[model samples]
Target: MSTIEAHDLAAGYGRVQILHDVSLRAAAGEVTCVFGPNGCGKSTLLKAMVGAIRPWSGTVTLDGEDITSLASHETLRRGVALMPQNGGIFPELTVIENLRMGGYILKSRKDLNERIEELLDEFPRLRERRGVNAGSLSGGEQMMVAIARALLLRPQFLLFDEPSAGLSPKLVGDVLKRAAALAERGVGVVMIEQNIREAMQVADRMYVLAAGRNRFEGTPADISDDRELMHLYLGIGKREEGTT
Candidate 1:
């Protein structure tokens, strides 16, 4: 079964619709990328799916049950986690403290501690900086912390928005590698990315959004080879074969 599915979802900031009758799905153990120009409602869709914003219509289902109207915390408890475009970390807290906060919903302290240790091993950067204030970390390091915090919840589906937003090429590569690893470990990943080439490289399937609606859905090869798609979505005039 698909890990998360949205059917004809309509949502927006109070009175102005950003997503219009949108529908999409992310399957278990695969990455489904959502690519679009800025302001096409990619983040908004993530928010809606995670119940950060209530949809005006349609339904969002997780593992076959409708969860469209659940609260954000409620959704998190149901095993859906959203890591927003801006890495959401508590600036005042230490890295380990921030991770502890993500485990607020956990009922078992032992499980939480075990998960934190596992995440620390998986992300050594976080382990090394665990005692430092989260805000002191570099942008890429902060992003890594944000992702690790979300994983502490042991979410079944993860929504990532612009995971490579403001980092050096190397860090962007690192972040995408981590995301790919998450997919490999059986967590469903839905990513909204501005870096089309990197996002497509990690994605098993992709959806192209334009003007607040889905314009195309296909494999990376389908989009990479289509000059019109590159020109229109990414504003690149032309790209050589194997460029992305």
Candidate 2:
């Protein structure tokens, strides 16, 4: 069964409509990448799914239950987590402190501590900088901390928005690799990314959004080979040599 599903979703900011009739589904243990040009409503869709933005019309479901109108905290409590495109970490806090904040939703201190230890072991960079302020870390390191923080909640569905933004190629690879690992461990991952190539590489399935609508849905192989589709849906024309 699908872990997260959105049906005929229409969301926007103020009176400006961003997403129109956007429908998508994310399955357990799979990475579903949503790609589009800037302002195409990819992030808006993520926000709506996580209840950060309420949909004007449609329903969002998690594990077969309708959660369309739920509050953000309620959605998080139901095992859905959103890692927004920015501002995920508390800069003044140490890495461990930031992680502790993530576990605030948990009532049992022992369970929280155990989860933190497991996450630290999984993300050694966070472990090494456990006591350092998150603001002191590089962009990539901060991203890692944000991800580790989200994992502390033991979320079943993870929503990521532009996780590769403002990072070196190496760090981008690292972040996407971690996302792939999360999907492997049975967490349904829905990622909205500007880096189409890298996102497609890690995704099991992909959706192309154009003008706030789903233009295409397929695997990486289909996206890579279809130049016309890429140009129409993603605004990515044929790449010349030595171009991004």
Candidate 3:
């Protein structure tokens, strides 16, 4: 599977640049985690890559095809999906309602129903709560709905912005577990997550972004062996004795 590549991408809200020549590649069938502090433009990088924010310069290419100018809807049509930090689901919509809306791009009712049924089968909790309002579900369940909704689009590359932002510890782990499962299914997953330890646990490749620019990209082993590096980038100190 081909990867999504962002080359020298510089983008932000009007007249304010958040990303500074950022470049990274997320290959299909792997999970690439972007770690950084707040105000580091992690979400902006996601926005730029998905064409939600047009880049001041550079290109977002999927398998070598340029998509920097595509609108958000058009980008999704290209089989790239993004689940943002917030507003990914309709609070008032039921589980089935949100899942059905996910396949709205396809007009065939039969196909839509089939897809929805397939997803429902895969996510049994959603199936059980098919009638419950989304706002009524637990935080992890709501995130499950978001994942199910994104999968309905049949995307090859999925980008998640801060999947574990405000959840409890258990819920945060649950969310990352779901992301890992997506990678196992051969979806190219690029996620910006603040839960550094959990992110490292499931990542195939780790990219450390500081101040909106790419700092370090390496395997998990690289991170594990470099205590000082973790301290410098993530403010994490060495584990004390008997703290394993």
Number of the top-ranking candidate, with lDDT as the measure? 2
* Superposed model 3: Cα runs more than 4 Å off: 238-244
Of 1 and 2, the candidate ahead on TM-score is: 1
Return the lDDT, model 3, position 100.
87
- For each of the candidates, the C-alpha root-mean-square deviation to the true structure, in angstroms, is 2.0, 2.4, 1.9
Arrange candidates by TM-score, descending. Answer: 1, 3, 2
Per-candidate clashes, comma-separated: 0, 0, 0
lDDT for model 1: 0.89
Score each candidate by Cα lDDT: 0.89, 0.89, 0.88
In the range 171-206, model 1's lDDT, one tens digit per residue, is 888888888999998999999877777777899989
- The worst-scoring run of ten residues by lDDT in candidate 2 lies at 235-244
> What would the per-residue lDDT of candidate 2 be over residues 91-198, giving only the tens digit for each residue?
999999999999998999999999999999998988999999999999988998899898888899999988888989998888899899999999999998877878
Across residues 7-68, which tens digit of lDDT does each residue of candidate 3 receive? 99998886888899999999998999998888888899898889887999999999999999
Point out where model 1 deviates above 4 Å: 237-244
Candidate order, lDDT descending: 2, 1, 3
